[model samples]
Target: EAGVVQSPRYKIIEKKQPVAFWCNPISGHNTLYWYRQNLGQGPELLIRYENEEAVDDSQLPKDRFSAERLKGVDSTLKIQPAELGDSAVYLCASSKRTGGQEKLFFGSGTQLSVL
Candidate 1:
């Protein structure tokens, strides 16, 4: 089973520029999540997808961020007009179920460096 896969392990962009990251979840896993980790803070959930349904996205910053899970296997997260403050690791994770108690397996993440 492939662990989780993410692309462009790092990205650099000027403030107000757009950036995107991609993720592919583990095989057979039906629950996927996108998280944001600041400099030293723990990962915070931005969105969660169960199959193709976005079960939760209350934490996502609507001002400049958007996400989607197409076909329920792969996902993309986009930041339009990225901000300097958006520089952080955009992590993708997956679990066996939608239950929050389930353990999550994370990808290395796309570390966005906004200038």
Candidate 2:
């Protein structure tokens, strides 16, 4: 399946500039994440941190995008020298195991428009 479709909401910014998106996950959750949704595609994991340690960040563009989770509660995703193709929605999610299953909670997302 293609997953849920996304809308075109965005935060406009010029090219070759720096922009940052912040997220605060639900309380008591141990996993925090940063994802990027490009147009109609599903959200792609940019970075996943398990209690302040980056466990998965291979999909992230280290040359341009950087992320950090402070105390494993709040997270910031920054992109320097934003490109036009960077226009998309940035999603933040948190997950925790409950009843032998992973429960994920997502944020509304910050959509970016690189001009």
Candidate 3:
């Protein structure tokens, strides 16, 4: 089975600029998740997708950040007019996901730096 895949590996952008990241999760995975990792803090749940439905996304900031899972296989996350504090690792992860458990595997992530 393939692991999660994320693009660009790194990104550098100016404050107030828009940026996006992509992800392709493992084959046959039933659940997918997006997490935001700041410099020294734990990864926070940005979104969780079960098939085509966004099962959990309460923590995602609506004004500037948005995400979608179009086919239930791949997803994208976007931040518009990003802030300096938005510079962080956007990690994509996946799991088989059963019985309310999501033992996940993560990708290398897109490391965005806002300047």
Candidate 4:
């Protein structure tokens, strides 16, 4: 089976510019997650979705970052007027509850550089 596929593995933009990342998760996965990883820190959850509903997004920057899961399959994350601090790796993951446990699959991630 194929794993998640992410587009434009890397991106470079000037400060105050806009950027977007896309992810297509594994088939049949019911839960999706978006995370951000800085240079020296572990990935932090930006958002989580169950189907088309956003179940958790407290960590997402509502002022500039927005995300959506379409039909519970494809997802996109966008940042407008991105700042230099926004440079990092954006990760997309998916999981399904099985036998009382959730197993997650992750994509390679999109690396962003805000100049």
List TM-score per model, in order: 0.97, 0.86, 0.94, 0.94
Writing each residue's lDDT as its tens digit, candidate 4 over 6-112 gives: 98899999999999999998998888889999998999999988888898899999999999887878999999989999999999999873333687789999999
Off by over 4 Å in 4: 98-101
Best by TM-score: 1
- Candidate 3: deviation at residue 46, Å? 0.7
Per-residue CA lDDT of model 3 for 65-97, tens digit only, reads 999988989999999989999989999998887
TM-score of 3: 0.94
TM-score of 4: 0.94
**Residue 53 in candidate 1 has what lDDT?**
91
Colliding pairs, model 3: none
> What is candidate 4's CA lDDT for residue 48?
89
Question: In candidate 2, what are the lDDT values of residues 1-115, reduced to their tens digit?
Answer: 1221223245789999999887877777788878888999999989888889898899999999999887877788899989999998899888763333686778888889988
Pairing residues by index, what is the TM-score of model 2? 0.86
Clashes of 2: 0
For candidate 1, lDDT tens digit of each residue in 1-115? 6899999899999998889999999998999999999999999999999999999999998888899997999999999999888999999999989775898999999999999
Which window of ten consecutive residues has the lowest lDDT sum in model 4?
95-104
- lDDT for model 2, please: 0.81
Return the clash pairs for model 2, or none.
Answer: none
In Å, residue 59's CA in model 3 sits off its true spot by 0.3
